[model samples]
Target: MSVLLEFTIRSDQFKLGHVLSGSGDMRFELERIVPTGGHTMPFVWVSTERDPNEDLPRFEANMRESDSVQELLALDRVDDGGLYRIEWEGQPEGLIKGLAEAEATVLEAFGDRNWTFRVRFMDHERLTNFHNYLTDHDISVHIIRTYTFTEEGARRRDFGLTNEQREALVLALQRGYFDTPSEVTLDELAEELGITKQAISDRIRRGNEKMLRPLLLSSAAR
Candidate 1:
């Protein structure tokens, strides 16, 4: 299940205007689109159920909210699957016309130097907990798809991720949280986030089973 929202913002504003807030370089596939007008623009978007932080608990928490997540959790028979709604309220005429004429819309794609390029999925605390865990232990737990159990979670407690080990992987690749070539050590990350090393390890391990096994190790390892 995948969901995405894309638009161009020439200035710094929110709601009526585009919101751009990201860092550094990135590599993305561009599937050209021919806009058909009215909320229909050419763009590519994908969705997954893995913990953005590479932790099950955190992933689970995020699942409860986040409208874009509706597809992923709904696809694999998610137990205690959450309920959400899609709403589209008519906007005032003036605001709508203003965005259609933003100056920055001439860009070829999302860029590091762009005035703004912000995108986000639903983020939950359980997933946050998992991220906190990996950072505390100083483990470069590579990508590995596997099934793991934490004292919490429903039956089977297994699923698929879009091939990302942890949120850090995205951050590292995109240069979101890192400013230098050196990777953010796990121990330092955990301390900054204030979580135990073992807890982080457990969350990362469990996260592997949920959809990130490809991240830290082999699928069998999880």
Candidate 2:
């Protein structure tokens, strides 16, 4: 059985986060990570509430001058954001190395001020190793939650969520979107994530349905 772990780390705690600390109001979503010999290349989607035309240049310049960034490439540019491939210097330490050592798969990761990572390990032992590795390296992390992946009958019990859905749901919960009178609005969440209001709305709605279906069905059967 695989275990999923969700945790949070401050921007100042990780090398990649330190390099991007001057990214202004830009929000980053890590699309994928590729390990190459001692180095790691991460494809990230960069977005901002401001105009990308003005922000992108500053972003590119910062990365080029950062000691941590070995190489940078702009893969795609959209209206609001762009995709970038960044190769980091050999990381003998930090979050990337720890994940690699524990054989964890990063399911979703994004942040502006701080980062939240949802990752999976083969089992509880691997998850424990990951925690131990981080502690050994002096990397402090706040674990948000953990759950085991299991199957029942012909159904998949992993909540049946897409990455986008999971992100939306997590952010909503964190921001108190479901609070009485709502502490946050959909538009605000959209702006913070550099996404459109409609997109966020659909994600929350669909995500709710997927999660509720299983629980509601199980209750009725009982």
Candidate 3:
């Protein structure tokens, strides 16, 4: 049985750590991955609460200096977003290493202050092995929750939506929130989920992005 695991990692211990420091209001959203010679080039979308013109150069420079970052290849400005292609020096203590060792698949990975990743394991044993690997490296692993994956839910997860995002999307659809004549308001959805209005909105946005990205990629490929 496939299992889903949600966990957090300190930003400093992972990629883009040097570019983001002190938990400033910035976010790194993983866009795509390209396998290079012996490294992986991750194209990331970076957003900040401050001015991009002033901050992106600093971010690029920091990436070049970070020990985990092997090469800062490209940095492009896309509207209000900063896009980056970085050759990441593999970190043994990182989630990717542990997941690879355990033969697990990474579903979703995003966060600013700290990264929250949703990983899928083929079985409980693989999950246990992943946990042990991280701990053996002295990496503090924070397990949020683990649950069995449903076939229907797994199809919807191809876009990498987290559990919270998936719940919000399903609830909104069931409540006719996306209908022509909307059945529920943001505030109403927020109350129903016991979260703030902004929180619900953010979840929906992220969920939609995750759900649509795959479709867009396939279209471009063909």
Candidate 4:
């Protein structure tokens, strides 16, 4: 059985996060990681609300000065952000190393200040090993939740919803947010989850769309 883990790590604790501190309000979403020789190269999308033309140069300059970054290549520019590939000077330590050692697959990873990651490990043993590796490295990580997926569970959880979305939807259902009269309000849900009401609302809305889209499409085809 595969185990899915959701955890949070402080920006200063992770190498990439430390390098990206220069990005100001920019957010990074890791596209993929490539292992070369002894180093790992990460391709990430840099997003910011400010003008990319004005910020990109500054961000690049900051990254270049970082000891962890050996080479930075601008891949492409999108409407909201640009993609860049970074080559580390040496082998990455901490989370990346632990993930590689445990052979865990990064499902989702993105953020600034604090990064939240959803990773999948092959089994319970691999998850244990990954945790042990992080502990030995003295990497401080807060695990939000873990789920072991069986075949049936995987099918049920396979809607395009993210972990946050799924959690929001589940809590909403449990608290009668979907009821006609509504026993719970968005504020309550957000408070319970330690997030803003707007965040909770967005998750529920997006989650509903993700879960309903496939079913509605299939039914229409039928």
Cα-based lDDT for every prediction:
0.30, 0.82, 0.71, 0.82
Q: TM-scores, in order shown?
A: 0.20, 0.70, 0.64, 0.70
Measured with C-alpha atoms, the lDDT of residue 35 in candidate 1 is: 25
Q: Say which prediction, candidate 1 or candidate 2, comes out ahead on TM-score.
A: 2
Question: What value does the lDDT take at residue 202 in candidate 4?
Answer: 63
* Candidate 1 lDDT over residue span 7-121, tens digit each: 3333223221221122112112112222224432223211222332333334344433443222222212122112122111232222222223221122123222232232221
Better of 1 and 4 by TM-score: 4
Off by over 4 Å in 4: 151-222
Backbone atom clashes (below 3 Å) for every candidate: 29, 0, 0, 0
RMSD of each: 19.6, 8.4, 6.1, 7.7
* Full candidate order by TM-score, most accurate first: 2, 4, 3, 1
Model 3 residue-pair collision total: 0
Once superposed on the true structure, which residue ranges of model 3 sit more than 4 Å away at CA?
13-19, 22-24, 32-40, 75-77, 89-93, 151-207, 213-222
- Expressed as tens digits, the lDDT of each residue in 105-166 for candidate 2 is 88678887799898889989999999998888899989988887653323346575768889
TM-score of 2: 0.70
State residue 221's C-alpha deviation in candidate 1, in Å. 45
Q: What shift in Å separates residue 8 of candidate 4 from its native position after superposition?
A: 0.8
